[model samples]
Target chain A: MSTVLQSLSTELADAVESAGRAVVAIHARRRIPASGVHWQPGVVVATNHTINRDENITLTLPDGTTAPASLAGRDPSTDLAVLKLAGQSLPVASLRRDAPPKIGELVIALGRPGPGLTASWGVVSRADGPWRTWQGAEIDSLLRLDLAIYDGFSGGPLIDAAGRVLGINTSALARGVPVTIPIATVERIVTELLERGNIRRAYLGIGTQPVRVPESLARKLELKSDLALLIVSLESGGPADRDGLLLGDVLLELDGTAVNDASDVLAKLGGDRVGKPLAARLIRGGQVKALQLTPGERPTSRAA
Target chain B: MTASMTAGLAQEVAAAVDQLRQITVQVRTHRAATGAGILWNGGEPEGPGLVITNAHVVEGERATVELSDGTAARARLVARDLRRDLAALEFEPGRAVVGAVVRDSPPLRVGELVIALGHPGGLTGAATLGIIHRAESDREGRTPRWIRADVRLAPGFSGGPLADATGRLVGVNTMMQGGLALAIPAVAVEAWVRRSQTMAVS
Candidate 1:
């Protein structure tokens, strides 16, 4: 090869190598109850609930070595898992701090999409309203990616061009939208899962429905015009029932803060409220009553 | 080795890339749902006839692999390290083929020579060359630890081999940016593969 040609060839080769290293793939095979089976993408962060002895998992690197990864800890409340790799010096992901991704920032999702490490780039289309996931948990903040989320990129990192991870690619909106768990939320969940066996969550065993305070009802009971969490069904031994709460009670406030919606109550109760007392104010039969309830440990489902 | 020898070795290895074809993978149930390509190396699926691709290629799948030649088979998926992104595919049936040797040290400084081989764009056997821009860890960026070169990588180039002027397996061609390509340092991959194998056995 001529000197110039050799130099050119060398430069091209180096570029190919560097770009390949940043790409990582996560894979998982999940068995959904009643749904039969489901496939997951990206690196499988095996949780105690999902990865079992009969299940199989493999982790692949940029250079293409595949190894079976074992299950670590899994906290379903947060949907986080810790996977230990016998492998080391594996290229760690770049974490973005200081500033969260702006709502319109362009981000890239890389994983073994459809079989090999592939890159899918998109912009933040919207950072909007909370949505309840399939697990029946509500997320207050979320990022909407423009690209379509394929099945295999779940646990893979959604990174910026500078290579900082913004979040973990989670699910895609069936309506042509992709969703990722924000890095801040993921960090908190992962930290909790690693430190504790499970995510500590406060629970009130009552099914709630958000009802707009009627003008007539508001006038009769001095209620706000905004939405309020209405107690629908109270579990027999729940904290709300033990705190002298009634079935027809309209929740007005929690912990001295006015409640605007059902999600507001969930936010106050779910995280940072485990094993603590919350003062709940409610209106029953046109009478206002204040009750202090000491929330108890959430009941664990037997499924996982 | 001398610079001339290194250059010659690169040519020899580059030439060998022409004979290499196909990477084997076993797509797990979840991986298969993502709609991935199949590596077809001919012959039987079992025995020594397996394909070898990047470990990431077969993530979320349980699999064993075979090389292009019908002579080698390896047990796959013993252990994996997420930090390094390396996995060891092991099989008891086939003889262990001696893979290409890699240099122990990092690549030469900026503007030095480098080369890569892989099925870029599904081109079963191809060789491309480029120059090193710098020697830096991947932590500074999102790309993997590699020799950042000016090589171009099309689709399907991942898990390919990268060599220095001496034909040593210095890195594994993995990704590309514009015209810049990245390769995982061979020493790093080798070290992790060995370590994962130990854990798989014990």
Candidate 2:
């Protein structure tokens, strides 16, 4: 009477039962509560978009007890927020960080929108290399699911068949499409957010748009590429403005890398690049000009 | 070994679906499209069989029930409960039909596999597989109102059987809500059937 089908069902149920121990309902927003994972000791990880207000946040633990939680920090770029829970002996999520989830691998999304723990199973639809989000945060890996996302699915944990946490699921990262923030990215963000209460990135206060450089100008400037980014706006007294970089400068290269798109510029603006002077090559007054522009730490509230 | 195990799983699922299809019947009424019905009770020799479906599927007192083996018969509505969205129909089969084997003990677990057989979009015997989304806790020794599942159910899937992996009937697919399929637990349906049959006898 022992069949693979029955064993599979039992194992799946066992996995949900084991993993549901760490999943809790986060009451941070209106309407139905969202899900969060007890990631580390006294720490819970949830989605930033689900936390509507920072004050008066509470959590319904796996044992069906309500506990007050304080906001530790939030990183909107990764759609992750950390909360500090006190004096609760709850089990932490067992994270599978050694290997990334493969395409077509069986996975389950566990959430506790209310007192009940809900589960939905499916396969990993798309698993690709690292990709950048619209907010310029680089996710460690791209994980697109082929499962039904229920209400309060955001901030829930996507667990493997063995009941190990693969990543945190969020519907806000990919324009409402369900995507998981992998453990590598979550670990990095959790460390940084817990330490500094926010994520830091290097920013140059200027907006750029890709423009086709005139062939005559390209040939005269000895530029290798015919396309360059046109600096359209400059923030007053900002990093680029303070470095004497003018408006309408056709940016050709930054730190020896060709800059043909806005994302190309963002690739050079990681958190480590803050306060570091970068070699800039641009076309100013129909001539190639080189300048050392130091990048400043971006404000938490400012985009780009 | 892995390949055989996977094949075994697939074969077992196919067998379960086939067993469910035998007890599943296509219900047609003059007022609505073709829906599905479960063979609730396959009566004794020379007795009438009982079929259960959604009340919304059968508008009047009469309906046409077509078994999976292509046997068609005129059925009379025995009981209709709009509150529970359940209806019972009685039909005289030419021979003995198979009744659903409902799972009543060892309450369902969350994330346990569940299979649904329905006639979606007029398609006969369509089977879909999913897991139990949330298994309600029966603290008060009462059956939960609705058994919510993650399986997808279309318009023509109303009043079908939602069985477990081993093909035991768990619930009856009633309607869909918030993208989740809601079903009346088989135990609850059994209680309702008992009450209705008692009333009919009196």
Candidate 3:
């Protein structure tokens, strides 16, 4: 090999060595095996979809020792779960918040599918986002890897050529698409889970679905999107109903944010907007009407 | 890896790619398969011409072996050990292919550099670089069952060679676990092939 290639491989090998140390092999399910990476000193972040039972989880440390872990919190919308290892100290993977890896840059995915640390190499296919998954989960950062995910790959760390973690890759939210939940998203989710135990969402008390807006009305309204929310049902005297929103009224925007679909509305109704008066613009018949609604506390009974 | 769709490789190819490709074969099973194989004659005086691949690569009893130079041959299943995912095929030694150089590289340590040569996802002659993630026996003390590496092996990479930095075959790329490439070690492949040939002779 040329000196340049040798140097590249050697450097990459070093990165995987340090980063793989933070990767833990998680046997989240009694039957199915998965992987998790340490986000904090004792906190491991994993994909929520694989955690069948809420309790009695096991994590295989890089040293090959088993330790009991308890689920701290889980957000199904984003498919991320946090597990706290009992009295165990594991190496925390360093999250790179600086410049992102450029497109075409080499990336490696590390996981503990078995007792051993397994690796997969790919390239950063799509790295720009503050996008939402198809399930309507709001992600602060998004990464679509060119890498193909296999068994136990969900919840593993996706590292750049330098070994810095890009995010936690999960198959849950992507619906078979390879998506990586970036480090910033992992940090945010883990913080919320550690502090509040769950992501707080605002309640609209209305069921809605995405519908296409009439071209004539959309152009006159100077709307940027072709999709709008069609209100299906209002929870008796709920936020939308109380705010003078009638059934069948098309929702265009909430607090200046476009409500293109049900997920878009859900994405806007985050916990921060709860108890806040939000200006909602909707098209009733052929006219666009603006109304004010104070978002209420979301019921904990509602599954994400 | 969404940065760019790299048809050739996710990472850059090194100086050893040409050497690696010569011994690599795009091993396609008659069961409608996608896999890579290594051309190994084993220096056997009688019926030594063989193609080494994963047991799962071949279906029924027949397969089409495409050599590195694009020569295709019809091969018959010789022997297989499903437990280890290793199998051998007897074919006419038409291509002057040499067995992969088996180096003395042993005690495979984590973070050691390696490369994988295979036809991943039907993209023939693709290569990926990685490190030896782990190399060990299972709980049953099965020595060198798998060589776990970070090198990406997609649907078509199975049965290819996972070689060391020097381009010597160390393992036969097989299945994947959690996206990591799993391979049957070269030593294990040699043993399996030797045992299968002896059985065929008897």
How good is the docking of model 3, as DockQ? 0.27
- Error at A117, model 3, angstroms: 1.5
Q: Which model, 1 or 3, shows the larger lDDT?
A: 3
DockQ of each: 0.03, 0.74, 0.27
Model 1 Cα lDDT, one tens digit per residue, A116-135 = 34444557887766665544
Give the share of true interchain contacts found in each model.
0.03, 0.75, 0.30
Error of 1 at B27 (Å): 39
Model 2 per-residue lDDT tens digits across residues A131-239: 8888788898999999999986899999998899999999998877789999999999999989999999999999999999999989887889999999999999899
lDDT of 2: 0.91
Per-residue lDDT over A86-167 for candidate 3, one digit per residue giving the tens place of the 0 to 100 score: 6876778988889766677778777777777666667888767688766556788667778656567788888877788888
What are the TM values for chain B, all candidates? 0.63, 0.95, 0.84
How do all models score by TM-score?
0.50, 0.97, 0.76
Against the true structure, candidate 3 reaches a TM-score of 0.76
Off by over 4 Å in 1: A1-24, A30-56, A113-115, A127-141, A172-176, A212-217, A301-304, B1-202
